[model samples]
Every structure is written in structure tokens, then in C-alpha cells.
Target: MSTNLTSETAAPTRVALVTGGSGGIGRAVVERLARDGFALGVHYSGNKAKADETVAAIVAGGGRAIAIGGDVAEERDMSAAFDAVEAEFGGIDVVVNTAGIMILSPIATMDLDELDRMLRTNVRGTFVVSQQAARRVRSGGAIVNFSTSVTRTQFPSYGGYVASKAAVESMTLILARELRGKDVTVNAVAPGPTATPLFLTGKDDVAIAGLAQAVPLQRLGQPTDIAETVAFLAGSARWINGQVIFTNGGLA
Candidate 1:
């Protein structure tokens, strides 16, 4: 749970820093990257125990990983986390900004503090992490940012949250253009109504079932489904840059 890492440097592998690795989609991405033989930095904000659990899962599966605690919203913490990755794994090859916040409310009644937190964590945090990743990630490496399908659905009570993700989508496009000659790819994955804890909260079973049925796929998306898309973007998907790959199973 502490920042003190387990000092058993394994053989060299692709280095990845996955912000919010303790959560559902993030955990899936971490496991997939580990399976791809990457040395992962499991970044977490508060749930160090969950992050450590993620790391253990990878290590137990013959993969190497380390858990680091830091606030993704703070530039200092973002940079420090990247620095840790560089120090631990020589240099970062991939950065996935899956850290985000979803506080839903109508714009008329939304609290400014909640809005600020969403913007700070989901928008500013992504920019801070991606900006650093843009500069430090090795050429031929990739940067994957998380966006939501709500940006397409335009649902009620999700105004602020959708706005933040929209910013991520836009920023990712421009970032890909800016990282043109670096051989680094920038893209966003916009998942729709995934069956993560973040998506299940505050909803009854019936409501959740109805929500799942609304999707054309006829079921809520699993984290692995999204992780598979991320894996493709990370490896061997060269020339597929600057695009938002919507992994929503035809929902979007």
C-alpha cells in the first residue's frame, strides 16, 4: 500500500503507466497490457489496496507491475508518477489516461464544486498526464485516453460529465497531430455503458437491465471488451492514430 516498491527488477519489457488502475476498466487494461508482456505502473489515487491487488494479479500471472499512489489531477503528482516509471523501467513506452470522474446532474442544479472536480480530474488530469506522456513516451509508443459514449448520446443529467469527456476527445485529436513526427500515436477510446462499478452505482437492477437492453448489443459491455480495443491500439495498430475508436458495441 505504501509507495515503497518491491525491488525485484525483472527482465526488460514495455513500460506502461495506467492511471486509475484500481478500477474496473483500468484493471482490465492493466491485465491486458501485462499479458502483452509490459512492465506496468499501476497508478492509483486513493485505493492503494485495490491498486496493489491489481499489481499482485499481474505479478502472479508471470507479469511485472508496481503500484504507485498519486493524484492524477495534480501536475506534480502526474509528472512524479511518470518519473517513477522512467526510473523503474528505463523509460515509458505507453501511457493510458483512464483516470476520470463521473458526477452526474442537470446543469441547472449541478453544484459548482462537483463540476470543478469533474473538470479537474477528468479534463485537466488527462491533459497533464498526456502532455507529459507526449514529451517522454518513446517513439513508436502510444497514448490512450478515456472518453465516454455519453458524448454521443447527449443524455440528460450528464451535461458536465459529457463536457469533460468531449474535451478529452478533442484534445486527443489535436495531440495526435502535434506528436506527428515523433512516431507516437494518440487516440481516445469512447466506451458506452460499461458494466463497471462506476456505471452500476445509484441504479436498481431493473434500471440497469433496461440500460443494458437499450444498447444495440443487448448487454452491458464488459471491461475486457474495452480492454481488447485498448490492446489493439497499443500494439501493432500503427497508422491508426488521432481517431476515437468507439468500442460501444454499436451503441454509439
Candidate 2:
């Protein structure tokens, strides 16, 4: 579909570009933002099919959305993705960077390549996208980056992942400060063990149950839970800047 947008026409709505929007948590965010009346730019790295599905769903629901594809870690690709959204929707108002990867391995035995890949996607990707958002997002816009609860939990097999997320947390705080007089909010969401394909791929039922039980709520977090947090950040939660909101059911 054409997204029914163009640069020549003045934008009549707030626009949001959600990276990794074809995935579980990302999809939830997209749907929620659509409901909130933001024109959606659903971004995916390698899965056009999933991206199209997300866009179709939004369109079917009488919302505006278009699928955008690009490598989050590549500056040019990410730039193009942002440009496409702006070209279509007039300008970007909110950016939620949920594009990330997780490969669990202990510190000592972890593959260097895996660590690099994770850092590239989670760290560099956030940085690149954040850079663009900082430059392009309109005043009163919000930038929400994704982090993981493993950084606080200090899990053994999550050393590399935790390290990557720690960088995200740091960057989020610094970016918020850097945007001193911009009136834009920059924050990070640290989700704790949400029941997404990314988080559920390797664990057994028993292990999953154990994790769920460990949480104070005695249940795994749903994508919608995190999505609600994001929607809040992307909307009127202006004072909640430079903070990492953990949406993990009180799972510290």
C-alpha cells in the first residue's frame, strides 16, 4: 500500500517510527500507538512479510501505517528508514527503538562474534536510530529505547546481553541530558522476561514456570504490558525523561 501519505501534503497526525515493529513486543507497540492516533511506520530488518502483516492489521483497523525495512545497525539504512517515514508522514514525532538481538552465553565461553553482533544491533542500533531521532523528532516528541532487566538481575548466562543493555541505559541517560533545551523526552524501557518469541525460544516449560513464579506477579509479562508502558512514554508522560522504566512485573 502507498501509506496514503506524501511530503506535499501537510501531516494531520502525529507520526511514530517503531523499529523491529514486526516482532512481538514491537507489534504490540505499533498497535497501541495506532490506537493512540499516531501515523505508524512499522520497521523490520529482514522480515518484510511480518512487517506487511503489521501494516495490514493497522490499515484494517482504520489506522495509517506503512512497512519500512532496513538494517538498524547501518547508519545509511537507518537514515533511509527515517527519511521514508518523514517523506510519507511529513515529520516524525516519536521513535521507539525495539530492534535488538539476544544470544545467551557466559562471559568466559561466549563467542566474540555473537557479542559483537548483539552489541551492533542493541547498542549501535540504538545509537544510530537515536541520533536520527534527536535530529528529526519534533518538539515535545519522545524517544523510547529498549533495554533488558537482565542488567539488574545479573544473570549468569546473560553477561554479554547485560553488557549491551548497560550501554543502552547509559546512552539513554546521556542523550536525554544532551537534548538540553529541545523539549524532547528520551527514556529507556527495561522489560523483564516478556513472553515474546525472542524470550521464549530456548526455555522449557519448567524453566519458564520457574521464571514466572520468581516474578512478584507470578506470571510472565505480556507484550501488551510493555506496549502500555511505551504508549505512556510516547504520549503525555513528559516529565518522565532520562529514566529507565522497568516493566517487568516488579521483577528486580
Candidate 3:
């Protein structure tokens, strides 16, 4: 399937539903997927305006997309969101679970509520979404889950967040095995200190500069950087399943 975002030629490449499509990384993934010829369902939790902006951008550019509001942690919301996608496009071919929360605090002082929420959305949410994708998406479909580099390099206040992402990584591997012979690839993408909102918070210019300097690339990662890897995993690379491909610019 192929479509001209700028009206060169418009053909439906495939259909994708990207959870958290309103956020920085998710937004880039949604745009890249649309450019790759996939009709999109841009899902958001509490950012309807941002999600609408994403849909409008895609449509205005000549690609096809729709804004969907739902909570990733809720099965009913996910079912409805998937139904919306099937209604617009033909069927689901790719599902990217990027809806995650990163409320950081020292383990010793971390609030239980924050931990619970992160696990529910990041870990459990991944399971439910992947299950649905496995059952409903076409045979050549794919499911990409998000992990974090904190699982590789320990950070001071990122214990809870890292733990949540670790669970995602674990489940993705098993899901790949369980889907044997289904022709659907399951994988996880782990990003490092990206320039997204989650990484830029509560930090001054100097701090961000220092953080960037820590990486060999001497800068934070752009969302498109990660999205490129996601596109690869979702495309014709069936041999690369059940792996955590880290796109950290050498930070890991």
C-alpha cells in the first residue's frame, strides 16, 4: 500500500493504531507511519487536541488518519479504538503501544500510586493491546512495544519507571514465542535519553547539555530516530522478532 502525503500518489499501504499518538515519540511514529502509506488511528489518553492536530496534519498532507481518544489501560477503550480503526481503514496491520507514564522518584521515596499507574499502563496495557492485535490483525501484522534505556543503565530516580518498562520487555518476548507460526512479529524498542517531554522536564539548559554530552552522539535522540527503527520492525523484517532493539544513540 502507498499514499502520497503531499498528493503525489495516494494508495493505502496498510493500517496502524498508535497509542499515545499525541505525545512526542508517538506523534513522530504516527507521522512516519502515515508517510509510509499506512492509514492511521492516532490514539490519545487526555490530549484530544494534540491527537486532533496529528490527524489534521496527516490529512492536510494528503495522508489518511483519524484522532481516537481512549485509555490504554482499559480494555473497553482499546476495543472501541480498534473498532474505530477497522471502521475507517479495512483492518489492523500494525499496533504500536507507546502509551506510558514516567513519574520518577527515588525507590525509597516513590509513591505507590505512581508505581501502580505505571505498571498498569505500561505493562498490563501492553499485554491487552498485544493480545488484541494478535487476535485481530492480519497474518502479516506486527506489534511493537516501548521499553526504556533505564533498564540498561541505572538512573537515580528512574527505578519505578525502569521496573515498569522491564515488565514490558519481558512480556513482549513471551508473546513472540506464543504467536509462533502466526506470521506476526513482536518486538520492543528501547530508547535512551530522548529529547521528548519526559526527558526534558525539571532540567535547565546546562543540565540537558550535560546529559547530552554524556552520550557519544553529543545530543539527545529525536523521536524520528526511534520511529525509524519501529518502521523497520513493522515492515518486511519477519526474521527479527522477539528482540529488544535499542535505539539509544550509543547511550546504552
Candidate number of the best TM-score: 2
Scored by lDDT, the top model is: 2
lDDT of each: 0.91, 0.94, 0.89
Task: Report the C-alpha displacement of residue 202, candidate 1, in angstroms.
Answer: 1.2
Using TM-score as the yardstick, the better of models 2 and 3 is 2
Return the candidate ranking by lDDT, descending. Answer: 2, 1, 3
Q: Model 1 residue 230 lDDT?
A: 92
Backbone clashes in candidate 3 total: 3
Q: Model 2 off-target regions past 4 Å? A: 1-11
lDDT of 1: 0.91
Clashing residue pairs in candidate 2, if any? Answer: none
Sorted on TM-score, highest at the top, how do the candidates line up?
2, 1, 3
Residues 104-146, candidate 2, lDDT per residue (tens digit)?
A: 8889999999899999999999999999999999998999999
Root mean square deviation (Cα) for candidate 3: 3.6
Predicted structure 2: lDDT: 0.94
lDDT of 1 by residue, 1-252 (tens): 566645565535788999999889999999999989999999999999999999998889888888988888788898889988889889998999899989989999999999999999999999999999998999889999999988888988999999999999999999999997999999999998899999888879998898798898799999999999999999889989999988887885
Q: What is the lDDT of residue 133 in candidate 2?
A: 94
> Against the true structure, what is each candidate's TM-score?
0.94, 0.95, 0.93
Model 3 lDDT-worst window of ten: 2-11
